[model samples]
Target: MINDSGTLAQSHLLIVDDSLDELRILKSLLDAHHFRLSVAFDGLQGYQRAQTLRPDLILMDVRMPKADGFSACRLLKANPQTRDIPVVFLSAAASPEERLTGLSIGGVDYVTKPFLAEEVLARVRIHLQLASRHMDTQEGAAEALDPDEVLLQAGIALIRSRLGETLTVDEIATRVGSYGKKLSAVFRERTGLTVFAFLREERLKTGRRWLADTDTSIQDVADQLCFQNAGNFATAFRERFGLTPTAYRKSVRAGRLIEA
Candidate 1:
């Protein structure tokens, strides 16, 4: 049974959205979790309600009429009265850029739309618990991520944005404001691969996709991936796929190598 005798039941949640159907769906989900909720149809209304009620948490939609979630979050964060209230963005935009933007502008977390109900409940419970901890110990730090995690996240953002270009661990570390060794250690610890190894894997994965889909020449594909030269790329490719780039494409076109 959903408890009415816990922290979750008493915590007030404000959900800002434009879709009535989504509002109903979320309300039903949170109701089962026994969370008290207030609704807003747009960012402007959400901000107004936030100011008035100062709910324990805010669930924001990115795109809305009258105002957007980003703008409302900015306004809320600027005001001393509502600044500390945790706002989690529930948006359909799944790109890394979108998620980063929300985080940059004071969103505690960003959950993409079409989310699992269980995941939503889990995230809400965790954030609310964190908020409770902050109240107990008035640390009052601004955003959830500490410096090291921020650097790691920024490094990943850089990697995704610059996939086709050659990158060094030192360069990524410098960009994220850390040294190469520290970045390397963190990267290895989190991913079980050295930074260079991870980059090579990403490049090879892209090369595999292009070879399978496009009729581009092997040398041209190598050039597109910013490989040192076609020969080096071909050697790496063969080692990875058990076939030369030329052979892989030919076998794929001839239906000899079944695609998984």
Candidate 2:
């Protein structure tokens, strides 16, 4: 089903490895599966190809001559141009800790060296399917919220109506799914955040407002945000706003800040 024309009918893959023999083997294996393939010999070239080709997925090697896969993955994740691209590390590093480090650095999956072709294909298929679903969700979200003002208004309405209650992804999805996935995508596209991220931001904003405007204690604010405990609430608040609840309240009281 894959073709060289770069359409959805054909999935495009970029394989990056220092070993020409390994690349050829992988290319042959994927070719048999009808995947349109591209190759890069090193991490630098891989990064460039990823940006220019915009392949559906990337298979990256861990250790290479210039710019290793981990560094490249971190670079790609940091760049807005390629942050959303799913990278799968095809490496000889088989330790659990090594695999975890690869994932933590932005690789979505890791396949060790000498992997079976079937296993490789299966993992590739799964990641490609997820990327396709994410794209579909984004497109649907855009179409649902063609009007920018309407989406913002609805998002605000959701915040107002749902505040002080624990929000779930399903709840947010249900509310936005009414118009279609397009609305959800539109909200994320416009705000540069997922539905969950937006909800968390709103919840934090509300919590900060309460802390600043009312005589409520930090525990109350945590409860208001439906956070399980004050510690979790404080951690999330600090991570989001760079301040503890008490510090935030003190800043607000001193007129140093308005909102989180």
Among residues 3 or more apart in sequence or in different chains, the pairs in candidate 2 whose N, CA or C atoms overlap within 3 Å are 140-181, 140-182, 141-181, 141-182, 141-183, 141-185, 141-186
TM-scores for every candidate against the unseen true structure? 0.51, 0.53
Q: Can you tell me which runs of candidate 1 are displaced by over 4 Å?
A: 1-7, 139-260
**lDDT accuracy of residue 44 in candidate 2:** 69
Best by lDDT: 1
User: What is candidate 2's lDDT per residue for 1-260, written digit by digit as tens?
Assistant: 23245334668899999998999899889888777899988776887788778888999998886667765675566455576689999999789987997886678999999899889988988888778767766632222222343444445455565667776654543442223365467667788877667777888888877888899988888887888888998999999889999998898889898453
| Cα deviation of 41, candidate 1, in Å | 0.7
Model 2 CA deviation exceeding 4 Å by range: 1-8, 139-260
> How does candidate 2 fare on TM-score?
0.53
Clashes per prediction? 0, 7
Per residue, candidate 1 scores C-alpha lDDT tens digits across 139-194 of: 65455444345445556665665677778898766544457998898788878888
lDDT of 1 at 209: 83
As a whole number from 0 to 100, the lDDT of residue 104 in candidate 1 is 82
